[model samples]
Target chain A: MNVFADAIAWIFSPDRASGALPLSEAIWTHLAFTVVSVAVAALIAIPAGWLIGHTGRGRELAVALSGAARAVPSFGLVLLLVLVLGVTHKVGASTTAFVLLAIPPILAGAYSGVEAVDRRVIDGARGVGMTEAQILRTVEAPLGLPLLIGGLRSATLQVVATVTLAGYVGNWGLGFYIVQGIQIRDFSQILGAALLIVVLALVLDALFALLQRVALPRGVSAGRAPENEPVRRRRRGPTAPAPS
Target chain B: MTWVTSNLDLIGRLSVEHLRQSALPIVLGLLVAVPTGWLAFRFRPTRGLVLGAVGLLYTIPSLALFALLPPLLGISFLSEANLIIALTIYAVAIMTRFVSDALASVEPSVRQAAVAVGYGPWRRFWQVDLPLAGPVVLAGLRVTAVSTISLATVGILIGIDNLGYLFTNGYQRQIVAEILAGVVAVVVIALVVDGLLVLLGRLLMPWTRGRRAA
Candidate 1:
């Protein structure tokens, strides 16, 4: 009860502003895992999506595969991976977990980004005799940037939260604190871990928002609501789920 | 077969109890979320805070969250309280988005007409807005339902036994049939619930088909 009460008091304590957390290490490790895994997924998924979308084939197959991937349940897959890969403190386990986590969002973003690219714009660029490479680099990247950023944002958040769960498998994460806190029934440690995670999520989300604006076309690139509008921090992924 | 034969009545009773317990938390969640959502919509500042609180609840792993709560509450402690609360937190987060959107989505023209007819704020809300928002709220409810079904599997860690009991039991004990049964039941339930939601969504919001198609 002290654990729970202390946690509440700690959280609701008037000195919350001055209270420190394990936020820094958690943030750094989480961001590294999230950013790297997502970047890698993008590197793979974007090209694949561009190819599939540009050709208007294989998109369904890729999406269906991702849908199947979603059903595998992250924890279950991680357990299986531990057996196959042999766990270590190295990034292998967490990276693999994040990779699986990262794939769906990247694929969704890339496909939509490509499909969402206006045909007329592509045609106009092509008419100027831009090669496929030039057209992709110039036209598609700018157009698909928002959706791509949206995908990355969601993938990052999902990875962070799931990574917490991953800690129990001996992977050692901020979730280490959470799982440990739970065992001893320590609320401060648990709450501390939880608080650390949320702050990290929001910060990473903000960074992505900044990156999105810089990465997107002038019209689409606005941070949350730039200059005046309220910034709605919506992290989007969510593929079409099963027909049901 | 032996397990079932030996524990036939126990199995039956447990299933019934589990269903009842599960349904209560889910219903409680939706009810709480609706009012929170309405207030959040009314007071914009509260929206983020409420959703943030709910989201924080969600990020806490199911077992850990449950453990934290039950200790504090005591026989105000049912074994299922934590699961209920965690599930409710999730349901609220998703449902809040649905409801707030639904309320805001009430057509301004309709609101204007309601005002002209001297329907006060409460009347406009109850009669005009709620009716319009029904489908979205249902959709949110369905999402909550499906999500809850999945989260219930985590209940195994606490020995709070639901369908997950079957899988965890079988897997740990090396009983293949039990694991298969559990896995099948969960997957089928999720599918059925999801399909039902889609059907309900369509039935409730016939107009959504056009929107989806477009």
Candidate 2:
């Protein structure tokens, strides 16, 4: 009957959700909510952010919008969306709400990532008769991939954590535990729900860390070239140090 | 002309009410979080974990985060204290990041210089470190301020009155003007508050102007 013991048991139990299965619809629904939102946010953010970053004027507005997006509370944004579009709208509306939550990091990442790509590298790719797409595909994306992954890492963690609040609008997730916990004054349930959220965040972050490593393109490591090794020897003529 | 004619007064009233809702929590939240951050720096492992916990705190949905408080604290259905508590937690999340980053940024050379001058750690922290770190801390404060202003809208989702009430209420009643007015008010407040924080940062630390500009 000890609370911690009860919580640990429930957390680890193989068949906690169903008659025979451990995971429940609530858990799956939460996963869907997070997945759909992150997907939507990324789809919108990447190209738009990259395009803006490529243009000198584009960076300011994109960054400003992201700044505003981050400033607004996720719950408030949700409430606004729910009002304009009812909860029953499901995928269309609910996903939009979560997308708002997911976007800031994506934009921040894409914009900064594109800008941070080495110009010399892009130029070299172009000189090799590579098309713009080829240059981006072969050069820029490889270097920017880590930052992009970093953004997804932040965005995914945020979506999972905030997804629980969706339960109040008839979408069940870990918020069920918190709601149920409060109704019974079961600290165990509250702790379980809270722990699930923390686990979800860490688990999601770890998976992305793995993906970032795997997803990163070849011949470009995130680290700067190793110590005491020359990255570029002088071109045998007076040349200015390359501008960042 | 038709729309503005009908809704002008209402927009003005809502703006004042929302500012009141927003300012109270931000001022109070900063008061609580800044001190907690200061206390946090004195300890090591615990401070790191506590701040990490705050980062996690950033992940919680603001509405649920607020609602859960009232139940646990045994407060009434919609307590101001509960609102403040939620705001405080959000504030702490930001303030901790600010304080820790700012403090960490203090160069070791400066600390060494202070010690060399017979200034003890406490004296040095109070005199040199805190002042030097003040601008960064204030930069974080500016971010927290902008975020808190927008978040105060979550106040309406619970039971407190704020601009969100306009949006929520208007939407429930199908009044487009109220909803638009509310959104505009929250945005304006955010913009103005951000400007003020920048101004305050510059005025408080003239050194911050160049740092920010550069």
Candidate 3:
């Protein structure tokens, strides 16, 4: 209605794009926060997850760590870090908090992906005289690719949503608009900024969904079809494609 | 320590407010999600569309959603209703997918056996399907509860009262102890809620315990 019209007008206004707090600048800042957070999280989490899955050691530690990480409220963490590190390092503090938010899912994905692979498959690889490193690279990595991508998808979504908090610490992002709009009581700008965030998140989700489909191995994709068949054939044994 | 001791009454009041804001949404979410999830599961064609919509809802940032709701619902900008409704949307978004998946996980053979036993669809869902799906649904509830509790703190940014009020107040005053206390209190609430849910699940699904024992 009128509100929607106002939101559209706000978005299209030349001042919105040209000012000190330009929408494009906010968008870029949001993207930078997401990219850096996700990349650093992957660097830390994926290797640890892989090692746990590969060696079957530290499974308990990973589980406990993920639980503890999940319990820590993201807003409080950001505030605490900002306080501890001093607000002068706002970007560093916020980035650290975002990285903490991003890690658990990626770690879970990598470890569970490898662990879900059939023991018989690993035995076969060993029977064929593959080295440990070769077995991981050739046998485990491809099969776990879908889940690894899934982990990245979850991490990206979380970071995108969370990086908005950066604005609270005086860092720049789309959240700045929402925060500022609230302060000034500008409904149109608030709605406009929110729309941009929703669009950005949906676009990223779709791109990741495409990546998941493309990355899935052909053999695994074939295995997914039988579950949908109408005739309740004999339930496939555990040998069916591993769940992503 | 001195800061926390002096502010004990403030902490208690905010904790209660936080609990009210968070817990109510979860209860409301379960009520809405069960039916919506049933619809998604009952109709095969709608499953993808329904789940996709919920997934998209979840990707909307909490802050944006909070701002969007006051205008959309015609509520006051600082209304507690806005916080509750916003959190409810998130809870529904998360729980619907979990409910649908949990139902889907019910074994075909088990469902067929219930059919052969002359159970109608409604009775079968209530008895066979729901019981089997209980553990998964409970696990999802635990996750939803913890996340909702964490998210309720975001309201402090917009001047709603919750444990996060401590963070904002502490930051403005440059009192590190107050911020740390907020962090500790929120984490403790999350852990206690999670533990209670686990205990409740065990009590309700005694068969799981029996199976493990056997």
Arrange candidates by TM-score, highest first: which order?
3, 2, 1
Each model's C-alpha lDDT?
0.61, 0.65, 0.80
lDDT of 3 by residue, A1-244 (tens): 7887898799889997776588788899999999999999999999898888899999988777776676677878888898899989889988998898888888877887777677789999999999998988888877777777777888888788777766777738888888788788898988888888888888998998899889878766411333223212312211101000
* Residue pairs with backbone atoms closer than 3 Å in model 3 (clashes): none
* Residue A239 of model 3, lDDT score: 13
- TM-score for all predictions? 0.71, 0.74, 0.92
How would you encode candidate 3's per-residue C-alpha lDDT over B54-106 as one tens digit per residue? 87788778888887787778887677888889889988887887677678777
Per-residue error (Å), model 1, residue B34:
3.4
iRMSD, per candidate, in listed order: 6.5, 9.1, 5.6
Per-residue lDDT over A1-244 for candidate 1, one digit per residue giving the tens place of the 0 to 100 score: 4655666675555554332334345446666776787778778877887777567789779866764444334543444454346544336866886787677777777777766776788899999999988888878766777777776776776677566656656525566666666567665767656655666666776787688767766665321322112112222233422110
| Clash totals, every prediction | 1, 0, 0
Error of 2 at B192 (Å): 1.0
Model 3: which docking level applies?
Answer: medium
Which runs in model 2 stand beyond 4 Å of their true positions? A1-23, A52-57, A73-90, A114-135, A157-244, B1-17, B28-47, B70-77, B210-214
TM-score-best of 1 and 2: 2
